[model samples]
Target chain A: MSQRHAVITGAASGIGAATAKALRRKGYWITALDLNDPGPLADLWHPIDLDARPYRLPEFDLPVDVLVNAAGLPPRPTTEAKVLRVNFLALRRVTEHLLPHMKKGGAIVNVASKAGAKWRENIAQVKRLIGQANDACLDDFVSAEKIDTVRSYDLSKEAVVVWTKKMTAGLVERGLRMNSVSPAAVETPILGDFTRALGERSTRGIELTKRSGTPDEIAGVIAFLASPSSEWVRGCNIEADGGLTAILDTENTIRPD
Target chain B: MSQRHAVITGAASGIGAATAKALRRKGYWITALDLNDPGPLADLWHPIDLDARPYRLPEFDLPVDVLVNAAGLPPRPTTEAKVLRVNFLALRRVTEHLLPHMKKGGAIVNVASKAGAKWRENIAQVKRLIGQANDACLDDFVSAEKIDTVRSYDLSKEAVVVWTKKMTAGLVERGLRMNSVSPAAVETPILGDFTRALGERSTRGIELTKRSGTPDEIAGVIAFLASPSSEWVRGCNIEADGGLTAILDTENTIRPD
Candidate 1:
């Protein structure tokens, strides 16, 4: 059999970069798309801007074996529009445009944040946030919903998580699969943003299992989802955040008599 | 104290109607909103079109102690956009408009379906669907995401469940609370939708715990969320689906080696 091709966004640094390396080791050729050049592991590199306005996805060869959407904006002093666009709208655009190109038995893996763990909480506003394509529309959304950049990041990740579920049937129709890996407080360049948004004491959750996860650790989960091993794990969001959400779930459980 | 006012949406039938009657017995003056005339269970009634474009909200007397959003479109022969608009978008519009009217110690209850049981699976798309307003936009969403009407209803309820989680901080800041009840295969006007969507063989999960929940039984959960009895249950989504979800969760559990 011929070597399969894979596309990974946000492949410059962090999880995307690590996933590219991991997949390369699995004998899959990588077509990397990121804001910065994803070093030598990429069999083919597309050094495109992640925050490109109006969001036009670059063309690629058909029957791509795997698509990993690890591109995203972290919570920091940034505009909510950019956060939503890069993290969600762009992700959706890429997936929708590329759906026709995915081969049977292919898999798609998305990266979401644990900040989005409670996405089930305020879904209406988050949905509106996801639809906002430009600054004008996003401004209206942010003002109406009172969402800050940090919340925007959470909403974007939440949207990514939900989008995976939404795209399940279409993928299943074609005998393909899709899933997401939700990571929180991992050791990445964006770690400071999480520390700032959630505070250092919030590390107590991560510390529960000892320490924060390395990019390679999260990459392991992404690679698993992208592999034939997790073929039955369709439409699932695997929590790869070092048991932080599990701790929160434990706190949330208070059984009634 | 003066009688506390409560607003109930979709109060003409099903869980909304049951909740309206249940709340009236709790000494709250019911302000019922529905597409149909609520048959005398409400102290005040507003018969408005549920499909009003741009979602114009009705004026309400302030200091509402409880708000129950039980209005929804079940999976029938309907457009995906209409289902999403009625079940998710319109519900959001009402809740956002009424947030300020809620006084301290207030509580909000949203009726979500068990079809949304897998909300944790795809949160991102659920948020976007919840944000879609009209069919033109919802059509773009449905086509872009490739979501069907049944999936739309599931996404809508998933959004409701998650929306309840998202509003926790804002509600807490305002000294108010919000929660949702996810009813599964309940014997209601909409139960046929579940049967059609999931089929007859699916009830084995529901039947494991005996019969499906009655509207009154679900109303009991909604009433609990609305009253001071559940003050500590902030941002919680109560699975009032008579243990079907529990069975599914047990089936999903992968015990550690």
Candidate 2:
């Protein structure tokens, strides 16, 4: 049989890049999409921009067996609107556009953040925002709801978490599975954003893990979700947050930001 | 000082009523709101229609020391719209309206469900939805998102969990605290909802604690969050789900829907 194809976003850097290389070494053909070129780690490269939604994937003759959405913007000086546009709208647009090309037994794994853990508290709004197919309507809904841009980053990841579960029941019948990975404070360029917002105590003071995770650490879990090992897993998010969430649950400490 | 005021919602039955009784016994002057009369447990009772938003909570002479939002609908055959209106919108409307009556060192504990544990995944969307206040716009927002009514129950609770955390920072600036209690399968009138939707295996198969929790058990946690004991907790959610979530966390099982 021909090698399986895995389409990965954010393939240029961080978890996305790490996942692209890992999947490649694991014998899966990688169709990498990102704003940056991944050098030679990827077999087929799509230099795509995530800001533009309704993202149409290039034609693929081989069956796309896995989809790994890893592209995202961390909390920074950018507007929250842009954060939602890239992390959520773009991810959805690409997934829906690519779904028909995927076959039975295929899977989708979106990389979410621990920061968006409160998503359960906001499922109604999540369903509301995810219903919009493109940028204009989604932003319109966001504006009407009056969500400030400051929260766009965490909120976008939260949307992906809900979308992952919401799409599960329907996707399973079509012979597809979906899941998300909520990583806690991975050591990436984005770690600085968190440190600034949360102070040095953010990473140092609390946490049983005691250190941030590496990109490859996150990629390992991403690969597992995209594989058949997680067949019975169904619509669940793997909290590969280094037991920080578990510690929080045990300590009954701040229910996590 | 005058007996501190504690405002409790869903005081008609289940966790809400249990929390009211627990708070009252702990020396709080209970100002209870519910669709049904509290009979005699309440010092002052307000008959509330949760389906109605922007509810005019009756005037009170004393300051509110704690606000416990325990109102909700279980997963059943109901329009997702109605579920969102009641669980999320009404909860928000009442919480915001009553904020003025609460002083520094006050606390808000929203009774959420383990079913909404996926809330961590939907934080961004949750924030967006929570930013909105009324029914029509919220409905329009939900309709735009195209969420099915079938998952409304879990979604609403998820909203509550996120709202609890999201409001913490702002509320604390005004000298208030906010948190949520996510209970697991409880032996309430609605325990049947779990048995029906998830089968008997839902409760029996999983959990370190074999039996479902009681309303008073959840109320105990609610009272703690509302008290000075949880003063340093900050913006977070307290999971009182009898180790079910902890088990899921360890086993990496399907996230509770």
Candidate 3:
């Protein structure tokens, strides 16, 4: 049997890099995609900008049996235009490029965040965007509105989680699987970027979890989604935030801004 | 007190129409948006081609206090390009457009479908998209990708839900609320279109609820989000599906396709 191939985006750092290393350790051929050069991983296939590039099968050049989309940022208050373009808009671009090569038993692992819990109430607005989902000028729409960059990110993530479920319905019949993982504050080297994005006051004390999760810890969950052991898992977003989501629930306290 | 202003998309039919009537009944001046003519709600402002038009603030010469994005299609297997565009691309455009005019105690409600429950396992892809939320050309990024129309609806809704939560961190400080609603087979007049979009097999028994819910039923939940009663309900998506999602968990024994 040909070795199962896994595609990892954002592979240059944090969870993406860790996920690539872990999958490689498991004897899987790894195709790592990132804006930054993927440093010394054995048998690595790196790609230029995923958003900008034409999605060749196995986006990194090898045939991919599994795809892990692990690139993203946290939300901050800023330009609405920028946020929508990046988080949700760019994500849709990446998914389109990768779909044709996904086979039965093939799985897609989408890295969502714990913030995705609010998916049930805003039906009206979500539907509208879904209606516009067809238009090719998504950026023109945002640009015309002059939206702040920060707000667009949050909206983009919301769209990504929603699309994961939608994709599941489409992929189910094809014997392909699609699911998402939402991690709460993994202590990725990118944690600093997250910190900068979220003003100090907002991120303060929220780090009550004595230890942030390692990139490897987050990757373990991704591997599970990609493997046959998780075949039955469909459209479920596993939360791997060191029980912080549960803790926030226990307190019934909201994440303070 | 000045009456709150609301911008609603897809207001000519189904949930959009119902939500428009519901909001009007609640005494808010409605800026109803849709491709179709607004019929009798002529007194209410209607924007043609919400997806194509630039989202100018002071819509109808009034600052929008709330935004209800209730437009989209059912899930189906389609070209990957179409799926991403419909599902994620446009959603970012509308949300980013309206964020500036939204004020303290303001709320943005997005409408998603029950199909988006699969985000837990796809964390990486979600992150990559989420990362773009802050970029200057996020929506343009989507336009450049050339996604399809049908599948994009579901994916966009998923992104919408995720983005709502991400925005909470920032919006909370501004006293603005962002939330989503996911319905399971509501009895909207648009059921036929949804069924067509969802394709034949899955549509067989979709209306398994105590008869499908009316747009009014779903609208009540949306009104709640817009009211002071739900001020603390930030970043929440209430499932108004008459427990269909929960019941599906028990009734359907998922089989790997």
Candidate 4:
């Protein structure tokens, strides 16, 4: 088989770095993108900060087979506007820019959060946010909507999930597939930020699941999504969160007879 | 790493056989069970008919690390009672019987159908069906409920999905994880039977997706679910149906502003 090329954002560390290793093990040529250099783990490196406006991606000569949007800012220690922009808008900007360069049979996997699972309940807000222009003033939007830093993080992820679904038909028509993975309380560098942002909610999820998920575990799901094994799977947000979503879903829906 | 053991039902053909191959590639000792012989695929084989009133599984000295309940019956050329029995009841029976032998940190993956996606809508009927005793008269129940062959097939799978969710807490408490995979149309031997039963519904799904899924595609999902890579995922029903569920979900929920 010929070698496949994968472009992964946030490839400097955590789930993105883990995915880089996993796909490298599968013999994929990795093009790592992040604010910091991903070192020797990347076959090629591109330093791009997601928070920068006019998000410009370098033109690629090679056809990309896989694109993983794993870059994001957590709630704590980040402004609400920055969280929304880095997490949602920048992801959209990168994907749109890379679409033409991606091969027909290529796949895209977005790293969403289990906190975005409540997208259904907040559909109106999510859709409104998704409707905003990429370069729109997110600060004004956040202030007007009264979205806090924590809520901004959740809303950004929720938008990611919804946008994935919205983009599915168009991508599938072009013979490309797209999906997302939602992990709960992963033991990444951003874990402390999430703990500070979510407080008891984050701790309770880890308590229920016994431990935080390893980045390798989330990457395993992403690797599967990028491969032909998941050829028939598209526009889905896979919950890799150790039964936390399951417990919440079942408890919320199931009633005693 | 020592070779782990996996017990898979319906191992004579389709997704079950494919799962056996996938797991074997990962150095798992496969114990295959089916009415027909699985031949060379099985390290050990047990012949058992799920349609039999008293479902009996052979004893094993090995501590099972994974269980894949891939046994099922389609809507066509099968009685309602047999369809329900083989698909849902037999699955529960085998899992309960084998729970003692299954190792802690082990996983169980149930094969369900996309037809069962409306499980939430039919939760009342699903819960009632699950409430039935193991030895209850399924034929009488079908007649009383006025369920036809197709409805039986859907109901059986719905029951499987709900049962997976219902069993999650208890199983997790025991250090065991359980989940289900729902595939759309797949090009298996039973594809004809499903086509005959579902008619235009099945063909429309195939048309929308451009083609049917391969058994290997579904098996890849089952393999991931059975591995430590999916340690955090439990009680979730993964839809591996080529964006069919996603289209339905997005179209159903998203409203015109």
Q: Scored by CA lDDT, what does every candidate get?
A: 0.73, 0.73, 0.62, 0.89
* Candidate 3 lDDT over residue span B23-67, tens digit each: 888788877767687776534655555334343433446777888
Fill in the DockQ of model 1.
0.02
Summarize candidate 2's per-residue lDDT along B145-196 as a digit string, tens digits.
Answer: 7766545767788788766655654664687767777777777777787677
Please give the range of 10 consecutive residues that has the lowest summed lDDT in model 4 chain B: B248-257
- Per-candidate DockQ values are 0.02, 0.02, 0.02, 0.64
Please provide TM-scores, in order, for all candidate models, with all chains considered together: 0.52, 0.51, 0.48, 0.95
Which rank order by TM-score, best down to worst? Answer: 4, 1, 2, 3
Output per-candidate TM-scores for chain A, rounded to 2 decimals: 0.92, 0.90, 0.82, 0.97
- Tell me the TM-score of chain B in each candidate: 0.92, 0.89, 0.79, 0.97
Which candidate comes out best when scored by lDDT? 4
The best candidate by DockQ is 4
TM-score of candidate 1 on Cα atoms, chains taken together:
0.52
The digit string of per-residue lDDT tens for model 1 on B225-249 reads: 6866345445655555444543453
Per-residue lDDT for A166-238 in model 1, tens only? 5554565677777777776778888887777767544675665456778887887777667664444456666
What TM-score does the first chain of candidate 4 have?
0.97
**What does the lDDT come to for candidate 3?**
0.62
